[model samples]
Target: MKTFLNKVLVAYFAMTAGLILLNEPGYAYLWAGQGGTDVYIVHSGKDKEEKSALKKALGGDFKVKFYNVDLLALADYSGKQKAIIKLEKARIVIFIKDAPHELLEGSTLNTKVIIFNSGKDALKSKVKTFYLVDKTIAPPGGNTVRASSGSELNKAEAIRNADAVVVDGALDIYKAAALVVAALL
Candidate 1:
C-alpha cells in the first residue's frame, strides 16, 4: 500500500510540474512561431470567407498566424497572457470583427494595428490605426478609404493618408486584402 501511494504521489507531482512548465514564457513562444510571425489575425473564427480572403491576400510568402479571440477569452489567465505575448511579438496585428472586449482591454500592443469591422472602440487603444471601410460610402476623412478595388486602393489620395485606412466590409475579399496589403505598405 505504501509503495502504491508513493507512485501515485509521484505521478501527481509530475503532472503539476508539466503544467507549470507549459505556462512558462519560453514554452509560449513555441505556439507563437519559431521563425516569428509577420501577421497575427485576431478573429472569431466563424467567418470562413474572411479567413480565405486574408489568406489569399497575404499569399504564401508571409508567415501569418490566426488567433480566435473568443477561444482566447475562455483560456485561463496564463493562457491569455501567453496569447498577449504572441500578439505583441508579431509585426502586424489585425483585429477582425466580433473581437472580444476583454482581450482588447487587457492588451498593450505597440505595433501596426489594422481594425476590420471590429468597430470604432478598438481605435481608442491604437497609436496608428488603419480602418477598412466599404466602397459604397465616401471616406469619412483622410485617414479612411473605400476599399472597392485595386485601383481605389492604389489611388494617391488613398495611400497618402497613412494614419488609418477604413475598408468597406461589403467589398470582395480579394479587394479587402488589397486594401489590407496596401495598408501594410
Candidate 2:
C-alpha cells in the first residue's frame, strides 16, 4: 500500500508539471492559431444528439460545461466590469436568444461580435463578425440538418455559395458549437 501511494504521488506531480509547461501563456494551441489560454466551452448539451454532435464537430477533448449567465446583471453593473467578467470566466458564452447585446457593450470595452441568424432574426447584432446560418447542409441522400465543423471554413472558399457542409452522415454537433463560437466572436 505504501509503495502504491508513493507511485501515485509521483505520477500526479509529473502530470501537473507537464500541463503547466504545455499550457504556458506564450504557447500556441495545438490546432488553429489560438493562443494557449485555458478554454472551457459552455453549452446546454441538450441531449445525446447534441453531445455527440459537438464531439463530431470540435473533437472528443473539447469539454462541455454547464453555466448560468445572467446578462440582466449588466443592467446594474453600470460599467464595463460585467462584460469583462463574462469574457474572463468562460471561453464562450452561449445563449439561445434574447441575450441583451446592448448591455454587453461598454464604452470602455473594445467590442467585437459574431452573430448567427439560425432563422432567428432578433439575434442579429451590430457587432463586427457575424455568421448568418442561412443554409442547412444535409448528408448525402438525407434530408436532416447538421452543422459542419470548421474544417470547411479552413479550405472551402465556396462555403458562402454552398448551403452547408455535412460530415459522414449528418451535421457535426461541434460544428454547431463552432458556429456559436463564431457568432460570439
Candidate 3:
C-alpha cells in the first residue's frame, strides 16, 4: 500500500509539471533581423495561425526585425505606459483593431503606420506614411483558396498604387498582415 501511494503521488506531480509546460507562452515576441530597421506589430493577443502566416511571408529576410506585443491589458495604466514606451522605439508601427488614442498623440513624423479594420479615430495619427487594409486577398464564400478584394480600391494593384496598402470581414489577420508586409518588401 505504501509503495502504491508513493507511485501515485509521483504521477500526480509529473502530471502537474506537464500541464504547466503545456500552457501557452507569453504574447511578447522579438524576431531578430540583420537590417537596421525594426517593424513593430501591436495587436490584441497571440494567434498561432496568424503568426504562422507572417512567418511564411518573412522568407528569411533578415533585414527587418519583427516585434509583436499584446495590448489586451491596455485598460490598465501600467499596460498603456509599457506599450507607449515600446512604440517609441519602432520605425514602423502596425496597429490592428482599436489601438489606444494616446499612441498617436506624440511625434510620429519618422514612423510608418499600417492600420487594419481600424476606425476613423486612427486617422489622427501623424506618421510619415499610413497604410490601411481595406480587405483581404481571400475570396468570398469561404470555399476558395484564391484571393480577391471587394472594392477596386482594396485590390493588390490598388494597394500598391495608393498612398499605402490597407482589411475587412472574412479576411484573416495573418493573411492580411502578410500581404501588407509583402507589398512593403
Candidate 4:
C-alpha cells in the first residue's frame, strides 16, 4: 500500500511540473509562426473563455477578427478554398476547423494563422492543433498591413508586436510551451 501511494504522489508531481514547463514565450500561442508574419489560429468560439485565454496568451496586444465555422453545415471545397485564401493574407486567422485540409494547405498563406478545433481534427494533414507553421516572415518593411476588421488601428498595432500567442487551451500546455520556444528562435 505504501508503494502504491508513493507512485500516486510521484505521478501528481510529474503532472504539475509538466504544466509549468510549457508556458514560455513562443511556445504558448496558437500557431508556430511569428506574430506579425504567419497566420494566427485561435479556438475562441463566440464569447468563449478560450477567447480571453488566447488574448492572455499573447505577450502583447492581440486584436483579431473572429469567425465560427459550422463544420456540420459546411460543404464543398471551393468555399473553403476561398476562405483559406482570404485568411492567408490577414495578420491573424481565427476560425473553426470546418474547411478541408487541401484548401487550407494549398492556400498561398505564409502569414500567421490561428485555428480553433473542438478537440476534434487535432491530428490532421500532419498538423494538429500545433498549427504546423512551415512558413517564414517576409522582409519587414514599414509596410503597413491592411487593417484587419477588428478594433482600432493602435490596438491592432500592439497585437502585431506581440511576441507569442496561444492556440489551444490550458490542457495543451505542452504545445503552448513549444510555441514560445519556436517564436523566440
Q: Which candidate is the best by TM-score?
A: 1
- CA shift at 71, candidate 4, in angstroms? 8.3
Each prediction's TM-score versus the true structure: 0.63, 0.35, 0.45, 0.33
- Which candidate leads in lDDT? 1
Which residue window of length 10 is worst by lDDT in model 1?
Answer: 133-142
| Per-residue C-alpha lDDT of model 2 across residues 1-185, encoded as one tens digit per residue | 99999999999999999878877766536423544222232223233343344445545444434322353443565443554455444343332222333334332212332222233223222332233242442222212223444454453334333333343334443465464444343
Instruction: Give the clashing pairs for model 2.
Output: 53-173, 53-174, 54-173, 54-174, 114-183, 146-171
Candidate 4: C-alpha lDDT: 0.40
Looking at model 3, which ten-residue stretch has the lowest summed lDDT? 137-146
Stretches of candidate 1 exceeding 4 Å from the true structure: 1-33, 123-127, 135-142, 155-160, 166-173, 182-185
1-185, model 4: which lDDT tens digit per residue?
A: 99999999999999788657754675566434434433344332443565455445553444344443443246565765555555555554543333433234434344443333322232232121223211132212232222222221235333345432323222343234224323422
Q: In each prediction, how many residue pairs overlap at the backbone (N, C-alpha, C within less than 3 A)?
A: 9, 6, 8, 32
For residues 1-185, write the lDDT of model 1, one tens digit per residue: 99999999999999899969986998986555457778887777675568667877887767888888777657887776677667867777777664544465646567666666555443333444565544433322544544444556666555546544445455564555555554564
Candidate 3 local lDDT, 21-114, one digit each (tens):
6543641222223233556655544444443455565446523444444443434656544555566466666655454333443334345565
> Which ranges in model 2 have alpha carbons more than 4 Å from their true place?
1-67, 71-75, 88-96, 100-112, 117-128, 132-173, 176-185
Task: Select the stronger candidate by TM-score from 1 and 2.
Answer: 1
Decoy 1 TM-score against native = 0.63
